[model samples]
Target: MSSNEEEKLLSYNGEVLIFQLSQGDLAKEGTAKTCRLRVRRMTFNRSTSTFIQKSTGIFSMHGEYSGFEMICCSCAADFRTGINLPCVVIRRNKKKSVFKYFLLLLHSSNEFEQRMNFTLDYEMKDDIKILNGPSILWRHNRTSFYISSQNDTIVSAPVEFSSIKWAGEVENLGTILFGVGEPHSTNRESSERSSKSDYAVWGTEFYAYSVESQKILSGSYFLPHAYGSVVTCIHICATKVVNTVLRISLIALTQKNQLIWFQDGIPKNLCQLPFQDPCALQVMASDGGDLLYIVSFRSSDVCAIWKKNFQVASKWQKVKSVLVDDFVGTGTEQLLLDFKDTFNTDCLTSFKITDLVDVNYSNDAFDPMENDLFEHNLQENYSLTVQALERRLQIGLTNIQELQKHLLLKERVLSKSCKALVGLVQGKAYIPPYEEKDILVSLCGEKKQLPHSLKEKSSDTYHDSEHVIEKMWYRVLEDHLVVGVEIKNSFLSFLNDVTLSLLMDQVCTSNPPIIQCKNSVIKLDKVSFPATLSSPCETESVAKRIKLTLHNKERKNSFHDQSSDANCIQVFTVVTALSPLLAFHNFCCIVMLHARWGENSGRFGETCTVPCGKLSLSIEDISSGKYSVTLPEKNKPLKEPMEDLCTLLAVFHKFCFQITSPDCTLTSVKIWLLRHMECETVKEFPDSFLCKSLGALNGTLFSWKQKSPFEGILTVY
Candidate 1:
């Protein structure tokens, strides 16, 4: 959406913003079945109900024309479609207007939300019309929306907007305003009752009114309008806006009753539009004064092409409604005509804005406060509360800005100090006395989270061309990597020209680092690029995979031949260091295994050196675990009730439990297979060849061939 080409709708006078509706591809012939294409989208938007005059954000949101997203959703069916609509965004667009593509957003009349702490970097000099953030321009990304000044357009009497005055809690910010009744009788008999200063009682949202249009007033409210404010410019909120703010899902009316709302018995003007719910009901303005912008909720992109398709010379005739449904008992054509009339610019002239310098809301309150002081009270000295609070606010704001500047300066100094420290440490530690700025850059910042874990980020991209074979068992004691080749092409059973290479994606060698591969080893004082790790070309063979499965019909064992899968796999592992433990350095390493497959290609297959994909492992995995790891496999099949008993105090401190099979196996380890450390200690392990979830022994086995002779389960809680 190119907002750079701006053409506002509300800003202009007579210019109508014609929305261009995109046509759906569900094309059908004349004999096709008719179905309604209605879509309802709901998003939970939580907002703090605070009314402080903090900055309200208003940023430009764009539609599909500018920032369309591809949706690959799955339900009963795999539906891969391109929905031409904008995503629900929190920030503004960088290059286009918010409404550039279309206004597909749920517009709320409670629009002034002071949430985001941001500034527009400009001075405001008005009663503040635009929300304090990036401007939400009413721009059409497709066909530029049309606009006309009030000069060339004819101005008619604006819709009458009789502003209401309230008392009590909700005097300032009127929470709920009902206008579903006719104006009170203006006769002399009812003059005192129908006067503007009369009290307007409020009711609960679920209140049941009597025939007299009155309900038992309940609840207390503190109106934000307590400070008093006159309507500056009365502009009717769009239907979508009002429904969204009020969260009105449904609005049904009977034949006898018209959709009229009342504020203190004052009738409100509204368009007679047929809709499924309140969301489609138009909140019409009764009157207006000068020409101003109209807040339109409908986006220009998906609106009907209703730009006076017929001749404008003939009384501006209303076209037959193209709606798919009827309105009440009458045709929808007339209702649609009334809907367009709601946006008529001719009603701008009646928008008269008047200020209430001094308002007496005594009679308007259900319980009006009595005036206790006389005129002399105004002459006495008093405490200025709001002024003092404002001063305190100024001090806090001043401190925040000053502290932020100071932090920025200190951050710069810290960066310089880190570099100097890295230089000094390298000179003292390096054996060859080399200089590598990038290597030592990580001296100050090393990943501490997920100490030694590394894994692939995304699914493997290489399909049948997988040539990298991992050697994990060789380093199984120190490494946790357990993955193999995923090959599909079974015919090519051998890999040739295999080259095992290593590349350090990260280096934190403030201390000299050592690199080891196979029988080769090298200690480096500094780091360089394109390092080698066992760069010897070798060959590996793949075999056909076979799986045993029971025949569904025969109930007998059957062999399922997986010809595409490779059974024999070549594995490899890489350690970050040659220390006592595994990789402990906060670093990233990319292992590139290049190999050639299939050489007899004269007529069968081609011998090509294909990339086996690059695997970049980094110690960047973080785990913000909230709780300790639960008992390994306990409760997997539901918790087992422990049955322990102590016979007597004579043999106290001795707990006993009868074990039938213990559901474990006692496997003996060969003496020659044990390491020097393992041989020195007792290698007596518990029943290890058994499911721990089932049961272990007096204590379950933890590690295989360990020095610790006893095994115990340490439950956290």
Candidate 2:
């Protein structure tokens, strides 16, 4: 037996897509039916109370000709897997007691084609909760949810992808957001002790399966004591994320018109709602994030509104909330509304709502998920190409004379280029960056800028060393540091009797800055080589100095101070005997300072230029109190683009990550790239950090790092 095959797929546009099916009386051949899918603009209406269904789209199959009988029609979608969409499931009965089903999705709203079809083996029973786009993970009365092998009717999941958790039953299933889950209830014994004991009862006794995550989140929001658990329903005005964790602000309404907010599954006094039930039938936030609009029914047929300012005095006050009825509704009608301020008023002044009772949805519209910018990555750019030789006849003198009549029609475009068109047809414009995957044929030189601090430090380290910087690749190769001399006169004299000494750490020579410096590798791995570069590395000892001390806050102990000072870089600068008496380290780049074996102070010729590594840094932390810069709230077990980023680093021996926090908080950092090593105690505010080479980093860099998918732990306290 096989059921639920993808016979059609639908693409969701901004409008809501509705599916309605009607099976007519059976004829000699078969029963007549219509699977109608339509598009409806589910928005708010102020003028009209009665709703009308417009002819947006119509996709239906009439007059069945086959022997299959329509069993039932339902909707199902597993957003965590391949596609996040509500696919229509159609069951059927074939000859000889055989069973089959079809899964249909809109082909594409943009494409004028039929819907897509997918079929899965095993028959599914109805009366199971599938409303709101969730499906039960069982067949033939809660039977086994697993299959041993892949057949023509079903595909097998990957071995590693198989989950070990049980696909247990969800008692009293209600809402279907990501997966099926047991309805909320106030049944904890602690609830008898205290009305709020339900808050402490965090359990995973509901749906253990999810398409959104490998391990379903282990938390649920049960109704508080005030809200009864008698299968009551409430309208969800809006929702908000509480933090980086999946915890959210569940703002919902009650039959008592109580506008409540549940933070992390508990009702909190987030804001003051007016005694008149807030008059917030619909709640929405402003684009600026400083104001909110609340719409509610003031009277039997009158609408009222209020504004809550968050940035200013932070008070709830009345706004333009007047609209008409609050029109009466049908059993199937849905009211959608939006807040708008056409005028440049500080607060919202207008609201529009409408009733979409008989609208439709189908895969016949453009795919919002495919064409989205952030959620679903937009499609890659593609262009048609052809050889210049193939188009030689089309570009000949004969074609120029034929285009004379249409020349005037082409002027409508503001700017047009014939060369671009020619390139498009000839395929010359789409030249790839690489000539061949394994070969390179082009050559070019670009002017590169070296850090000025290196030259300045060289002058301060050695009195006789020259301040001039030569074009050099300091640590281009494995374990080898190369220095090029401009071969100038004043520079040659400085190298003479210079005793070299390496300070190992601090970069500033004028005076020790208030901020301190520490060096440590961010992550340590014993690999043969890194992906970007391939060569035998001699500084494996440097890596050996640092153990795998991950910055895991979940660990019972505190920070690791033993390996706080990891030998990440072995850089030495040119110094002279005349320079200030400085403490040197065990291993450093051999800097040419004035030579003298016994003297504490290096003999300097009154001038030396010490080159330091170029380091760019950007950090953020609070200054007033002792706080820990923390790791981002983990998306447990890990999920994608997030999981993809981890895999990217896992595949390669080394990874360079640009960390970011949603709230934009950071503190101390330690990074050890190929040759240069940088570490320092930094804060987000009050005390700004400055690198020896790149200077003070901009706070905007925090906002800029938002693109990176990786994050690191930070701590200063």
Candidate 3:
């Protein structure tokens, strides 16, 4: 028989038994006393065990049995006595019988049983249509059932399906599953029978429908599958309370019995399991369907369970495996396994599917060696950099030290040179002849007169000058003036005593003279003769030497006049006695004077001259020094008219000396001459003659010449 026919037969037998008992009880209670009742007897055949009920007709069974018993409902009469009851017929005597018959066949198995057992105290107002067979899986059949919670009524709707094997709902939409034939099916007969040729491909098909609208929401299409493969079984599981959109997991069993997972009908190989002859496949959800569990049973009692989280949707993880040794059944939330222990004793265990799965799984592992090597290389590089910097720093420090040392050495040499220069300026150290020549000749040439013959003299003369200067040279040492004088017999015999005078101009008086000798004054007069002078009997001339120092004191008063012309000239004088007797005649003294007057006193090119006197003297060359004489060459006897000559003779005389130091150069000479003398014509002298002749003389000459019958100042250059 077909599967649907078998289901109907089973349902009919169950309802008939319930009908007889329920009616008999009702008659015993007198609830159907007013209604006419009819009895029917039916016999059962144990060999065939078949029964059939026709609408308002007769009851029949095949293959009679000896112990057959039948009951009548109207009067509670029993027909158990030997009767050849192959069939029985009962007609409805009243409308109640028709209603009774209707209730007998129309009641579902569960309702029938309840009525017969008197368990239902309340009557049902409406009749419920029963499903006599498994739901019909056909196209365009109104076979699907839903329950309305508002009125608790069963709703039926016609749903479209083509070659669909399973149907379910995920979230709001119902999902339909079907098999699409392989590209080249080995079973050609099945392929040719397909009414829809386009869907005859070897893959899985999924379709979605809106349950509320009773309309298809998504198309019926084949899910892409592996080459040369087809899907055999598919189970879709979703969360219980749908939110936003439903989260569903599709577990598909292919023709090869290889289980795979599908997201949106796309295949994903997520789990690995040992292949076996699969007998059944089951899927369920837990934790409000956020987690899914799948179990597959093999012929050898082998079971494998897989778990997946709907939230992640990446892959499935193998949760558990068991060799049951007996059968086991997996429920929605739990698993029941039957097994034989070591003693062959049967044991049953239940487990929660969620507890079998691990939710967090990761494969994160690293090699320790790699980390160590990287750190070592980094440390080495850092050390190398530090070492390089240290080396460069050391080199820089060495260079700096060398530079500092060089600077210090240069400073030391400079300090020593400075000390030597200071000593030369203070006359504490004697400068070498060549170095002295460099200073006196080259440097002093800027403002002072240099001796012409000294420039022509040899190195021998430089030594001779050094020794000769010990007796007659004069120098400025620091703030003191040193004078060395040599007296010869000619000077001593000509005068009993000598006087030396030093005079400075108004500007030069800023440095007042401090006499170093007890007997010396600013103007020394009638100085005693030198002790080493020659005795009167001696015909040869002997020399006597004396040295004197003139210290300069700070000026007590100032002579700088601001109202005067800045170019006004100042002259300084120094006087020495050639003969005291001749000095009285104003013709026998040497006067050394220097004029200092200019915008800059150190500049000697500009000089001022004042007209004063005229005196004629004959200049002649002498071996001792250059000498000048005013007396005529003839040796005349002393006459009273020569008194004036004596006066002149006493004032001036022929003397010779040489200047050793250029510190005594005189650009202009000043003299105090007699103002009461008769006027005379003065002869002009050339600069060349004066610079040559007068410049060669060591001692200066200061004399009184008659210019007018009155006394006046005289200046000469």
Candidate 4:
């Protein structure tokens, strides 16, 4: 019905006059036989102006007794013809006892009743209100309800309440919220919550209570998810039956286009269906009995639509999978219960073709004359057929090949990028090679710490001038080695010339010669050198003996004294230091000495020393320790602003680094100040640079603070 008509029905919120009459008595209107009618006046929407349609007969009363009859009434639209309202007649039964009357009537405070336990019988009047008990108002797709109550004051409140008696068993359930208005506005308040997309589910429970003391009466959990699963195919079976039973039947096409029944839930397995080429399916119910319809195309020459009785599903031996086209279109076809239907190669068995033929050409008028017409028809028929055949033969191979090629290209790009990154990290191109330079060579040796198997052999004993041997050893002194390197060009020049040249310049540029006194020897023609070295610096007051040791003493000694006094003459030389400039060299200058021959003169005649350079150094120990700078008191004179700021920055940097650094060691800050001195490159950092650095540090510090594991216990301020 239209909204106007529905609104008119709702406006009649007043007493409703319901009457029950019999059909037999109403047919004899002219006769003296009066039908008994039971009339009960209950409140209804007084504003309604539409004709009321009810399924059951109404009840009312005759002159003196209750009569059941059909009443005839004329409507404005059909005024000329007589239309009747089917009703029943009711009368008072006086013989029934008071106790029996009391047992039949039940009342509540919300209801308007003239009398319930009175001695006299009650009669219906125009303005007198009677309780309607309960009823349903509206229903919809998701939520539905049946309002139930013991009584309703229809005269004033006029609330249409639902009664349990009106609500039949689940099998006899009907629509309840059919005409209900939208509960309230469901406008979204904000975009964030709107994205959630909230939707209403079915609420099965409904009750009537005072606004002050609301209480839950009766409720049930409704399955809304199940309803949403197959919303498009919802069907309501309205035919009534004696016993209520909900029989549901579902017919659906599987992902593989196979016909299947959704027996328990959704069809999850395709093997359960018999048909391999299903076309369409539908579901229907009558008298609480459900049926499934399935259509299938079996090869190009056959098609059928089959009906399966859902009530007999368990008893079915072999459900027929029907192919529909054979019986639908005009063709030279044959019907069979078992593989009998067939069509020619013209595709007369396709349901789509049959439907097209039915819609375009209702009558059989075969034309075989025009060539253009035949070509057009042939093109229409063969286009889809050839395309389908080609697609099946290719089987999506082109798409699969394209995807593989895309993945291969991605892998190649990733591999190339990874290799480039590795090369960059290992100093492949950015770091220039170190240029070779002349370095002073001084070999200083000490006694070997190895077992007897690796000891050095004794030199040949000869009565030679001890003071003379020391003079020949001057070439192996540490100072002479430094002077030699200063003269020759080395790869270290490039290291000192690079961007970080200042760090390399920190090492002492030059050193004085190292004087070697007492007995010592030198060998310039040796092929191999020793591993251990011993040498005395200039600070040592007394001259000591130089020792020579070998890894394998069983072999011949590789050293030879240059002169008879080689052991006596003092030797002066220089050795390369462990500075970054000379860090790349693989050789170390060393000085050697021999065992003393007497208290003043050295023994064992002569000795030599050799030392090799180490490849790497670690600064882990240098970064940890307590470091502090004591400032003069406030009363005392102040230092330059740059000096103060530098000291503060250095201290702060060390502390912040400790907190943020992954490899920081915990130590007092004061020790750090003692080890490294701050050189004032400038008086102070410019305000811009200082502010930028401070901001960056502050942001980093804040991030670290937020993520700190000991956030609450430790404060950064």
TM-score winner: 2
Runs in model 2 with CA error above 4 Å?
A: 1-101, 107-209, 220-246, 252-259, 269-717
Clashes of each: 39, 83, 17, 132
TM-score of 4: 0.16
Instruction: For each candidate, give its TM-score against the true structure.
Output: 0.17, 0.25, 0.23, 0.16
Compose the digit string of candidate 1's lDDT tens values, residues 180-249. 2112323445645543423121111111111112222211111111111211112122222243232112
Report the C-alpha lDDT of model 4 over 1-717, residue by residue, as the tens digit: 121110000111222233333322433544333432233333211122112332222222233222222211110111112221111112233333211111011111222221122222333221111112222112223223222222321111122232211111223332221111112233345323433212221111223222112222221111122122112211222323344432333344333433334432333222223434543343322222323342333442222323432222211112222222223123322121122223322111111111211111111124323333544687788977998989876877888889899988766544444333233323253222233112211121224311122233322111121211212111111111121111011111111211100011112322212222222111111111221122212111221122222432222243332223222211122223222112112222223222212222234422322111112212111111112123333233224433233333322322233342222211211111112221111222211012112223321111011122111111221
Native-to-model Cα distance after best TM-score fit, residue 565 in candidate 2, in Å:
87
Candidate 1 runs further than 4 Å off: 1-389, 428-713
lDDT, model 2, position 546:
31
Once model 2 is optimally superposed onto the true structure by TM-score, how far is the C-alpha of residue 234 displaced, in angstroms? 7.7
lDDT (10s digit) by residue, model 3, range 112-187: 1111111112222221222111111113231344332223343444433333434543444443323332232334
Q: Of models 2 and 4, which has the larger TM-score?
A: 2
Give the candidate order by descending TM-score. 2, 3, 1, 4
TM-score of 3: 0.23
Candidate 3: segments with Cα more than 4 A from true spot:
1-165, 174-205, 209-211, 217-222, 225-229, 239-248, 277-279, 283-292, 298-302, 308-334, 339-717
Off by over 4 Å in 4: 1-135, 139-168, 171-717
